[model samples]
Target: MDIVFTVLILLLAVSVSGIAIRLLPFSLPLPLVQIAIGAFLAWPALGLHVTFDPDIFMMLFIPPLLFADGWRIPKREFYMARRSILMLALGLVFMTVLAVGYFVHALVPAISLPVAFALAAVLSPTDAVALSGIVGKGKIPGRLMHILEGEALMNDASGLVALKFAIAAAMTGVFSLRDASISFVIIALGGLLVGAAVSWLFSFASTHLLNLNEEGDPAPGVVMTLLIPFAAYLIAERFELSGILAAVAAGMMMNYTSVANAGPASTRIRAGTTWSMIEFVFNGMVFILLGLQFPHILGRALLDAHETSDVQVGLLIGYIAAVAVALYAMRFVWVWLLRWFASRGATKHGVANAVPGLRTATVTTVAGVRGAVTLAGVLSLPEVLKNGAPLPGRDLAIFIASGVILVSLLVAVVTLPFLLHGWRKHKDPHAAEETLARTMAAQAAIRAIDDVHETESADLDESAAAYAADVTARVMDLYRRRLASLDDEQESRDLARRAESLEFTMKLAAMRAERKTLLALRNSRTINDETLNKLMREVDLSETALTARRK
Candidate 1:
């Protein structure tokens, strides 16, 4: 217990310092730095000892992080970029598994193809948390970032699904193609349905129960919001379904169902706070875990390397490298193909009707960096086979995955900045707007000035009201005329964007007003805190859902 406490304190300090370092102008990957810190601790001189449970890694880190990413992913952008997301999520993962697995088996004739495929599946998708951290740092356009986000968010499930199948085949010593296909379908569909249902139910419950005014009333609702992702995941997993898909579906349902029904102002405030907390805790845990595990995994790999031949080591390295490369190459090719098809249709409709240039596609490919989950899966690979037999090439497999992760992160963090800058210089106006839209936006300075003064009460205080009226009149007249003067499409879009922002702000204000009234009644001892909290949560969920869509 003392050791755990000390380790946690040191880990937290390292994470905090890493964050501070990242905010600096110098180009450094925070995760890489954290990993370096871990290695320093593990050095013989420092002699730090720490251990993390494999089950804890899966349960604690994976679900919430994945769920949070899924929850925040805007539905509108996802739909617009569906073709690319699907190709990357499903097609790329499947292809990488096959390509990586085949190459590994060919290079090292000792291990069975199924086990090799298991390793391949583990290496399939780039880490969303890692990608988000690195790409979020770069000045990439909004649309391409979302497309990359969607791919990373969705592919976690697909990669995991493929891995489960591979593991089953390896463990059972047999696999049926038809059965695997059927199971995959079932898992994916089941997770989706369960997630959607759970999220909807929670959203429904929250909306009716929230009473905004009662003291301490919002706490229960916050707890409920936190639980939804885990509940959705666990329920699906219990039925042998895809927990990842369930969490994703739940997130989507929360976005669409809750947001559509939420109060604009209070909901956004609450959801934003909740999401911010979720992001902080989950991200902190993930990166820290990544760092902490480095020495352990490296030690295992070194131990494995001792018994393995140099040829075998080279083969394993080449195989995982190939897997990472294959995933990137597929992204580029798929994006090019999709854009070509979109362009063909655009020729009839006009080239302007097509999707953005191949540059965005290239940027997406460069953003693929593997992180914690890939490492966890590789490390979780058992050291011993069935019947007390030694598992051939376990260490080599871990070493390869580690190399893939390191290389991918280095490439993404270093090169993404240049790629994004180039894309920014060659910006497409429409694509840029679509990409950079704020998820939880405030109203424009002018529109906000208009709305606040418009609502001032003339009856309550005449002098105050008169002053507000005068100010509002001048502001509106000046802005309305100034905005009316612009004729260009870009100018129109800028105004339209402002108007949209004002609309959501107004909606949020209205919802909060209603919530205030409901809470006043509750404060009169008419309603329980639990009921009030539930409703508040629903309202918050709704607001979050709506805000995410705009972004």
Candidate 2:
């Protein structure tokens, strides 16, 4: 096939597979189908194999995906889970690198400690996105899920930084702790500052120049939002800082609706749709691309190991399993220590959480699944050392890292359902909360309506005033009915469900009635076409609210 056609085919296939996953009531474990497709493509008759360009992969895919994740993570939840996030993101990362480094070196005698440490560093950062299956529904606690997300955001920088130092040590044969420590701090902190600055600049330009609610064209605002992630990554990397962190920082800082303070509903809708598509395509490509490399990695590793008596293929597989187990074992141990300290007197000093138990620890441990960063880091390893000799265990590093990733993913996929079977959480008390929220919104709208009457009707005739009062009265009636339902729930918890359903039905009926009126006015030619279109939009928005409910 022609190269362009081949690319098109691959994209279509991946998209179709994604659609299948969604359409199926019962999906297989995460990434299994994606991997299977790539594996099949590796067949000799297929005559098609995807190749790696690590730089391109990272630059093209990582920013948008990471930024999207950060943007969606609720700010309040992130802050609440800050302590646990820090422990895993930075502290556990340090321990894992140290422990797994030594373990890998012991497991594979030919692998140098520096190279082993580099592999450990690559595998240390969990992919927050990869943990989605594990954190699904009410299986995992919300706080734990948020902490995992927060941790994933920060550890990309920490793990990559550690990998940087390890790689340097392997190349130059000189490891300076003081210099590495100082550089790590500067790189991390600098990335944060750069990210925030870039975010502010984008926000300013989008709000002032682009005018997010352009009505005629929202493309400028959408385009700017797309550019911000890439710009943030490039700026941070240019400064020799942690671009991963910077991209995440930019995303977290951005208000998705920054283009307009309020009401370009279309722009908001467009931005969300665009970003969702981007994330889906980018993430799907990453896994499939990695799977395509399986042939090359395995071939090289086997070829290299086949020469040695002790470095058998079975031994390599065993080593991968061992590494995977050790990775999570270390995490479990760390979580236990944290909780132990928290339960002791450490909670008084605010260093630990006295309530963190086995459940949180288990979830945290399983959620440590390696992701695209691991692949990118490993594949980017230098092919030759400074002396122009073949880099030692470079192929092994890729194989090991890849194995760890698949194993980690597999481990979580197979176990999470069982772990989460007993984990349950009740529905949020949204009845009371949403009732209050809607009341406040209605009150604000009423005030605005009154202000419009005062300003615009004063100079008009009595007819306009009467029309205004009639409109306000109708609106207040709707608000009054909603307010009444707020205090109408039955005392019996079991009957609350039926009452809620009946209440929702009435609300839905009101929305449908408004829609009917809009259509009637349009049919009678009593409303201008433009006015009909605008009013129809308002009715549609109101109906959407009435239809929306927690599953």
lDDT on C-alpha atoms for all candidate structures: 0.71, 0.80
In terms of lDDT, the best-performing candidate is 2
Q: What is the lDDT of candidate 1?
A: 0.71
Give the residue spans of candidate 2 off by over 4 A. Answer: 1-3, 22-25, 134-138, 260-263, 299-311, 345-356, 426-435, 454-463, 488-551
lDDT of 1 by residue, 84-161 (tens): 788878888888788878877776666678777877888777776677667564366677677778877777778888
> lDDT tens string, model 2, 411-472?
88888878777766656534577767876876777777678767877876888888877877
Residue 317, candidate 2: Cα error in Å is 0.9
TM-scores for every predicted model: 0.74, 0.86
Would you list the clashing residue pairs of candidate 1?
142-435, 143-435, 209-535, 210-535, 210-536, 211-532, 258-542, 259-542, 264-508, 265-508
lDDT of 1 at 314: 59
Lowest lDDT 10-mer window, candidate 1?
434-443
RMSD of each: 8.9, 4.7
Supply the TM-score for candidate 2. 0.86
Clashing pairs in 2: none
